[model samples]
Target: MGMFERTASVFDDAMVLDEEYQPDKIRERDEELEQYRQALQPIIDNRPLSNIFVYGKTGTGKTVATRYMIDHLQEDAEHYDDVALSITWVGCENLSSSYQVAVALVNELRSSDHQISTTGHSQQAVFNMLYTELDKIGGTVLIVLDEIDNIGSDDDILYGLPRARANGYIEDARPLVIGISNDFQFKENLSPKVRDTLCEAEILFPPYDATELNSILYPRAEKAFYDDVLADDVVPLCSAFAAQDTGSARQALRLLYLAGKRVADNGETNVTGDHVRGAKEELHQSKVIEGMQKLTTQGHAVLLTLASHTANSETPVRTRDLYDRYKTVTEKIDADTIVERRVRAHLSDLTMLGLVTVHERNEGLNAGRYHEYELSVQLDSVLEVLSEEQRFDDIVEIVKQQVHGMDRT
Candidate 1:
């Protein structure tokens, strides 16, 4: 009794549910793993390493599984004396072009004092330096470039790295390039010579199903919360919602983690369906907020117009009607007046951004075909986002008044 203790906690280890947590075993990826293993077999055999390209949607265990297998490859290769393996893993997202990537890899291999600047070298000079660094290692190198498509159309590295030894660029080292991407079309757009070498063995990871997501989340939940903290229905609800969204295992885990946090913060036991729903709303709000931050001035105006219509009615708003609202909002906010055609285009862009939903309506005879737009997010949330921008605050109040009737169809 001398020492006071805190209240009972809900979490055992929250980081287990984090995005960066690499599980010792990957669930629902057995066949993918086997394919991955075969692709990397050349490296283990001390033969010429084959280039690999892995394609998968986000949260499909591509990065984690690759890291897992490569880690094992590094560990197992230690027993063999002939195989001199060096791994350079580059996240191409941070490197914009082939030149930057070359400079980055070259710097990555050097000691701190010997590093080069991010600029000040021609692309060829940087390539030369990178090859020099690779030759110094004088071994078989596996270059794992994650999100390789982030380099945009600059495909020099794609063409250069695979043929570095044959082209007399790297005299001693043999480089094996592995490209990973979430965008499938990026590979299709590659130059043929670049494509043939980098696309040696392509592995596609499909999105997870509800059952698979549930299977993936259970182990994480077991490790994240106390046995009695989570209700029976929590996992199923999270899995179903994520499966509905994109069949993403990461989304399911994040939902569970967020819901658990919500319950614990409220000092409640047994995370219920209410908590799960609350978590979903919070996540959706945050996602919309992030997406909104990236919109242009006209984009925001178009979105606000659609949101105004959606909040006021039970029915969807037509393209022409939505354009009128957009013009009104732009005028009130003292913004530029865009044409109806531009406004219609903005609606399509908004739909693509997932900020708005659209449906094609075939009108009987004279009305012809038209599209309708609706806000995909809650009205109050979108309004809140708009209010944060001082320029829109005044007009946003008027828009809110227009939405308060809620009787229009």
Candidate 2:
């Protein structure tokens, strides 16, 4: 057979399992959908729109549910003459501040040929341009900002846009800001003024439970695979594993897709629980490597220290001990060493990234308390990623020697 020739496979429509594929209807989200509909009811009633804040963890269907509701809202509004609904959607993942977000909004609202440059405009100038665009649309407008937490604490746009009418920024357009974020703390950290104006309607989307995930995966699996191609336990195993890890529907679907792909690659007809387990490991290693690759040089040094100790079975090592090893690694690389306090901060970052786990210990008032850290990932995985960087070759070798010496002793 030619290299690209078709072979025996299981997938009938693999794209159904993709992240961008929106199911005809969102599953197991009636409660959230109802709440969302209620939040958007004012627009249908010809009343002023309420600013809404949506909170949920990643893969909890926040974006998908929002799109679904907006679609329905737009269709329903057409029956009424008064409601001239216009929608603008912007992903804020790469936009870091209110200024950048405002600039992006202007570009999104403008025609391709009329779009403004991202720079060279003052903040007030950008706001004026955004207001002008909104006025031109001149109706009940829904501005959807996904991953809004990326704008961080600079929330001038969040505060300004929602209150545009009251602040006399615009007259013809009634704009409602709907901000979606995966970080729980983003809402809490907003300025009080911004909180009051932007979060007029707050909706929370909880992560999916195992049963919910099972419901979501079954249909996608049926569409993605041929008849009797998935073992009975395959979907259940994927759902259970994802629920235990993050309760993410996206993860569950990905697990199912990977399992089926593995079976198809092996020239087999059935995707088994074993294939699911193997796929889970592959996803985990991929996640670890991706996370590690995004780290800074100092972050890598701190992680390498933890990984080396982990390989020697010496973890749950104290902060001071880890700091000593971290300093040694930095010195060998001819990089300036940061203070121990800063080292602790890097460890905290690693902990947040799920690469390291930390525990607090107290041995009485005199001894006070301190934290101990260890690699939460497989040592082999960490070593594999670090080995790819030429700067870490000498450090990786030292780590191997330490492990070998410990084994001999």
lDDT of 2 by residue, 270-335 (tens): 889999999999998888789998898888888888887887788899998888888888888777
* Model 1 poorest 10 in a row by lDDT: 400-409
TM-score of each: 0.87, 0.85
Candidate 1: residue 394 Cα off by (Å) = 3.1
**Candidate 1 per-residue lDDT over residues 1-409, each given as its tens digit:** 5588665768889999999998888899999989999999888787667799999889888899899989999998899899889999888788779888888898888889999998788999989888898999988888989998888878999999889899888888989888999898988788888888888899998999899998999998999998888888999999999999988888998999999899888888789878899999888878878888778888888877776776667449888887777777888888998888888887787888788888899988978899977787778878888887788888778778877655453
Q: Please estimate how well model 1 matches the true structure, expressed as its whole-model Cα lDDT.
A: 0.86
**lDDT accuracy of residue 160 in candidate 1:** 94
As a TM-score, model 2 comes out at 0.85
Tell me model 2's lDDT, rounded to 2 decimals. Answer: 0.90
